[model samples]
Target chain A: MTTITQGHAAQDHAHDSHGPARGLSRWLFTTNHKDIGTLYLLFALVMLFVGGGMALVIRAELFQPGLQFVNPEFFNQMTTMHALIMVFGMIMPAFVGFANWMIPMMIGAPDMALPRLNNWSFWILPFAGTILLSTLFMDGGGPAAGWTLYPPLVLQSGNSLAFAIFAVHLLGMSSILGAINIIVTVMNMRAPGMTLLKMPMFVWTWLITAYLLILVMPVLAGGVTMLLTDRFFGTSFFQAAGGGDPVLFQHIFWFFGHPEVYIIILPSFGIISQIIPTFSRKPLFGYSSMVYATAGIAFLSCIVWAHHMFTVGMPLAGQMFFMMSTMLIAIPTAVKVFNWTATMWRGSLSFETPMLFAIAFLFLFSIGGFSGVMMAIAPVDFQYHDTYFIVAHFHYVLVPGALFAAIGGAYFWLPKWTGHMYDETLGKIHFWLSAVGVNLTFFPQHFLGLAGMPRRIPDYATQFADWNAVSSVGAFLFGFSQLMFVYIVVKCIRGGKQATAQVWDNPEGLEWTVPSPAPYHTFDEAPLIK
Target chain B: MTTRQDIDPELQRRIRRNALMVGGFALLIFVLYIVAVALKVAG
Candidate 1:
């Protein structure tokens, strides 16, 4: 066995060649970061489709209402699994995949500081996904306690709940390992002259994100473990019968969930930071402020978790404190929005797919953010809480926010990946369709939510039917728009114009400095960077 | 070897390319978004 030795082995892996893996062993035992990153991404894509399929079922059931397509119980399972699979199985892992592939390259490091752990961290995922997916077919079906796994309700879930718990444990362990790997790599493995300040913003955002993961994910693991114990071993971590408050579970859960929000968006921020500067033909405006704003958002995120639980009967002081803190987040977030716009101001600009999505992100995600601030008010939340408004708010942030960034990053880098330019016409078609479909899907929901359509219900009232129909049509259009993306991406991979060494007309990063398709190994020995 | 004067010609080219491309794309995306809002719905 090759010793999973320390140091630049990871860099060696991160910078692996575009050529075929000649032997089976290269597929199995290799410690190359890029190979592993590729594996993570492919796995996430499969998981995304799987997760997206579950959502389709949820939507189908809600299509006309009256619980026509599914039993209420199965509907609950769909909601839970849809959320779980997407978050754990797809989105978070996808970002980590990008990190593994890009971080070392961005930092000019050879690879992750600890390459072997990186392997193990990614390796654990498929098995974990298998375990969770397997629960769906089991006798009692998968856990129906929602992704939150609230007590008493969670207590009533089936033997499949055990599988869900184990699956979550596996996922938590993987995330922790990945986060630890990131923390150490960023701290220890930067190129010789690369200081913390000199590091890319994506790296900076991820550094903070990694710290959040390490701090908060353990609480998630601990909470879920207690649920396991509460089921089998008679612990009262969440059981009121054992004199434990179930509400305390929300505390532990949101501690993770809140940072988890930043965890999702921070990388997207890094992506925007990268895209904005390159596309704007200028240095990023207020670079230091952008960093501070990210840190500010992260800091504000920790205190605002209570806003989610405002209706749970906290004291007035507690309620007001959470209220103010949640609203305060907008200040930093607005600072970021302004910085992005300012970077684009008066600059000669063109719109490629990446910039297309990034610009959309600022507008749509801010709308979501504004709604989130609306929800932060205890009284207002009592009205909008668990309504379609919440649905609109989150999908706005996640769809146009996180998912857009991922797509944008992919398009931005596609030329480099395949050494061929994707068809711009088809790309614009895909972009237009998605941009239209997404807004149509979520925009009407604000009205439905205001009119009192509760979330997670399989059916709705007659009044909601019109909006719901509109939403479903939008959903189908949005789903169809993605097929174009797949078509464009797959076609580009097969054949296109030979990309120049620098794919973008104004590319500045180190990745573009290499050949069109980067050599299997980049910077094998430390380059003498002037 | 480490001096700023030793910056690679390739480096300057990449920077220029990144500048124009990033800027150009930014404008296009914004216009696309604006056109999106106005195109079908505009009376």
Candidate 2:
């Protein structure tokens, strides 16, 4: 076994050998995967606030439900921009950022397979984000048609429409490039003996995610571009009078959209798989099955896009096909959840921040998953469609599901990334606030949806008052608590107790074999794996 | 004393090929968009 002294000494030697490039140009011109990864992550953290700020505006507007702070149009703009920013800007990029940082290290690679392209991918994002955010300040306000960018409604959005489409194109291009980088790195760059099955779960999930991104991102680009032409070029692809079908747009968008949901969460599955085993001090219960389950979910994600369109007047046959396909996803997803629980069962489990968040993810994401199955029932969906319950369902999936894994991942690797220990007490505080705050915010919305409160409205009837108020308070608590998260990240990066090479005791991967704050360049000579 | 600057030629070839393929696929998306616009929808 490698001793702690040896770990610390090796880290010191690495630091002396390869000090980082100095100044802003280092960031601008650097193709080092670690530097680029840091850039992607920092950008995403900033956007989390930018998007979260927009959500707070939305929650505050819905606080009293009587046109309190902003007009209905502006309220619509807030909701629209919020979802676009959070999905395209925050969650998706955050996972990609993690992929960039972790994938090369986890595999025994010196750098990403395409280092220059990796730099290009990270750079495009900030520009795309700028264009999207700039729309809010434009004359007609941001694309108020909602993030779904549904036709006729989105077509009605003024100059902002073109900008939104262009932004989507840029974001899609960035993801596609990042996906290619990941695919090439994993496929070609592994050490000689690190066979496919011997690779880490994180690498496996990302390889699958990269495939999903390449397949679907262009479809989204195509759909949004069609919307652009329909609005600006006098093409009527969505106009009923001009031989265009509005329903056709929905089909195209959701084709990319539903798989887009899995694209975000699949990496989280990898992250959870890694964290659970370490804390449980056990090998993952079913490594091969976990991989198969991910592939199965990706396959199911493709056929089940039509579930989102159940209310759009498809034929009975169409609705039944979609409904059954959607339900089938629960099977593979259950295998994943069961595998995680079994990994934790009766092992030496500890509730450090990462494990706590992972455990929370299992329960809360399941709540989202369960509610999703409820929506899959075509007959019952008619009652629940477009209600706060639908909002509640997805938030449970995204916030605790994707975001929890993201936060846990950061905590899991922060020591390695910064080469220092973060304040454990503060990390726990952030997790509890987020856990309780997220539950408080979305749990009551389920009741409100059942109580017949529709979403995306600026005002509501007096009857839905209590839950809306409770949810708003929770939103503020959740939003502000993230500041604590930012503080923890910054404080750790600056300095703290020096970390050992294996920051955690039992993470079995190439990443832990490297020193904390890994060398600017690593694995020049690949380490041997049995 | 091989430094990080010396990348493998075989790796270089693979990276070049993959980059071109991704570029080609991106071009195909634009082609699909044009087809989407030109094709007349069924009433």
Each candidate's fnat = 0.00, 0.34
TM-score of chain B of 1: 0.68
| Stretches > 4 Å off in candidate 2 | A1-18, B1-3, B33-43
Local accuracy of candidate 1 as per-residue lDDT tens digits, A190-218: 55566677677888889888877766776
lDDT of 2 by residue, A1-530 (tens): 11111221222244246557799989998888888888988888999999999899989988985889999999999899889999999998899889988897776677798889899999999999999999888889889987888987888788978888899899999999999899888887876667888888888999999888888888888888778888899888788778888998888899889999999999999999999999998888899998899999999999999888789999999999999999999999999999999999998988999999999999999999999999999998999999999999999999999999999999999998999998899999999999989999999999999999998999999999999999999999999999999999999999999989888876777788788878777766665566
Q: What is the C-alpha lDDT of each candidate?
A: 0.78, 0.87
- Identify the candidate with maximal TM-score: 2
TM-score of each: 0.88, 0.96
